[model samples]
Target: MKKDYNFGYTKVNSKQKTKLVQNVFSSVAPSYDIMNDLMSLGMHRLWKKRFVEIMDIKENDIILDVGSGSGDIAREILKENLLTNLYLLDLNKEMLFEGKNRLKKEKNIKYFIGNAEKLNFKNNFFDKYTISFCLRNVTEYLLSIKEAYRVLKPGGKYCCLEFSTPKSSLISSTYKIYKSKILPFLGEVIAKDKNAYKYLSESIDLFPSQEELRKNLLDCGFTNVETINLFNGIVAIHTGYKL
Candidate 1:
């Protein structure tokens, strides 16, 4: 039997795990953007800005921003006038809808309500693939990685922005305090859902570290796997080339 994962470090199997994640995001969709600001102290926006700014996108590049919640990354890239063949994909329909609503004015942007593990796209389809702040929720990380690679054109770039463990013990301790106590409190007060925030904080600890993540990308046949850390490794941008 194939293994599936739950956010609480429990084993459930991939299919069930996917359903669980969809439920989670659906529950939090309404307050997703606000919670991001509260949890990251609005640094999430800056982080995305920096992430996209570094991509150096070219004209006519077919880019897919998977797990694109509320279209923040897509909006930033489009606003910069970087590319036109931008596709926004997400597992949670509600989250995708949110992105759609925000990006509707940009009529050229494409949208897909789909799974990351089994991408609903053709092979060698995208020039650049990006998954931001959503991998930790994916039911199968390796499959998602492979799907990103499979959909990319030769020499295409793959980028991921995700939570990671801090390198410094001091910073880790401080972050632990904030995630464990402060985040849940804010979630309860603002989103009226303490458990949702609690799951998110715990999920961070379950996520792979920088080195492990690099190896995973490498194992999926990605080359030049590199990571750029931010906020003392609370999050990182992992980039690789499909060669």
Candidate 2:
């Protein structure tokens, strides 16, 4: 007997998929941030900045930054002095360590190794839940959303920044060329993991569109769900309130 897992647009057996994803990240973790800038031409920074700007962060906010690779999102939030407790959770221990090392001086931060589909947190505990550039990579992304809702306090905000399909024909066509041709090339050259970067590029088109994702959030017990597309839908910031 075997169970299937999604690795980008393709499905594989559960163990196989998990191993592949782990290997991919472990191979790229050291060069991950660099490749991001090269691959996206630095647009990812703007997308992240916009996502953080929209978060309704208040004083003493307890935030769970799920899939917080290298702690960039967590650091951005902490820089604003908006959080009293900031938890950085990632499935991969290597990524968690990278975050811990980067944010070593931060006293209010904690790192945890946890799965998104099954987060180890108390219900109604988090004031904000942020998952950036990571939702689609989860084997059970929908379940992850439900788990996010479970942990968020009433009126808590759930926000995500994820790659999405472009709505415009011109931008979409241009993007296709870049991801298919340039992304993997840059990956091989920079990260020495061509396949890993290939998988990342492939996952973008496999992601749910903005409206469909909004509906998923609504179905998962979220309210006031909305999305703001960036760069004509190359990415989007989806947010909802748990009420």
Candidate 3:
């Protein structure tokens, strides 16, 4: 049977989609964090902080951060001393390598090379699962959400922070120009990977709307799904519980 795949705006063959995404992340891995800060004016940190605050992490909780590029979200969780175990998982080795180097001496963090759509962990293994700016890049968002649901314990929280379209026409238009023009240019100069940044912008524009994503989380077995718009709807944090 010929497998069907969905990549952003178009449908593609399933067998090749993973490789395509892998290539994109690999190309941008070296300067992903730097470019993120540049593109978002360091608001990514504030957005991640909101995610952590809303989760209200507890001590001795095992937290899993999927698509954890450079361990930014994990580091934020660790800083609060609310987590007993922090697992940073990503498909791109380069991204994990950068994270590992940044936290070589940290005892609580463990890096794992794994796909979000096919987590290797046993059921009910994590107290919380969080992803930042990554859900949009996944080839199968619902599958990844299902994986998160499988790994999280009952009553555990699942939070995702991702880019979304702004509601205001004026703001949306201005932001679109910046993303399509300024972001890629800065990414090329800093990351030296123009194509990767181009893909990032394109992916954000092509991703599902906030309401659609909330429904996706519900479809994947999440309960009480809610979305909180940040930065004037330019980004949103979606939270749900496994009941």
Using lDDT as the measure, which candidate wins?
1
Residue-by-residue lDDT tens digits, candidate 1, 1-243: 665577656677767777777787898899999888877789999999989976768888889999998999998898687546889999888999999988788867888888888998999989999999989988778899999999999999999999998999999998999989998899899988888888888899899999999999999999999999999999999999999
**Candidate 2 residue runs with Cα over 4 Å from true position:** 1-3
Per-prediction tally of clashes? 2, 0, 0
Candidate 1, superposed: residue stretches over 4 Å from native = 1-4
- How would the candidate models be sorted by TM-score, starting from the highest? 1, 2, 3
- How high is the lDDT of residue 54 in model 1? 68
Q: Model-by-model lDDT, in order?
A: 0.88, 0.88, 0.86
Model 1 clashing residue pairs (backbone): 4-13, 4-14
- Per-model TM-score, in order, reads 0.96, 0.96, 0.94
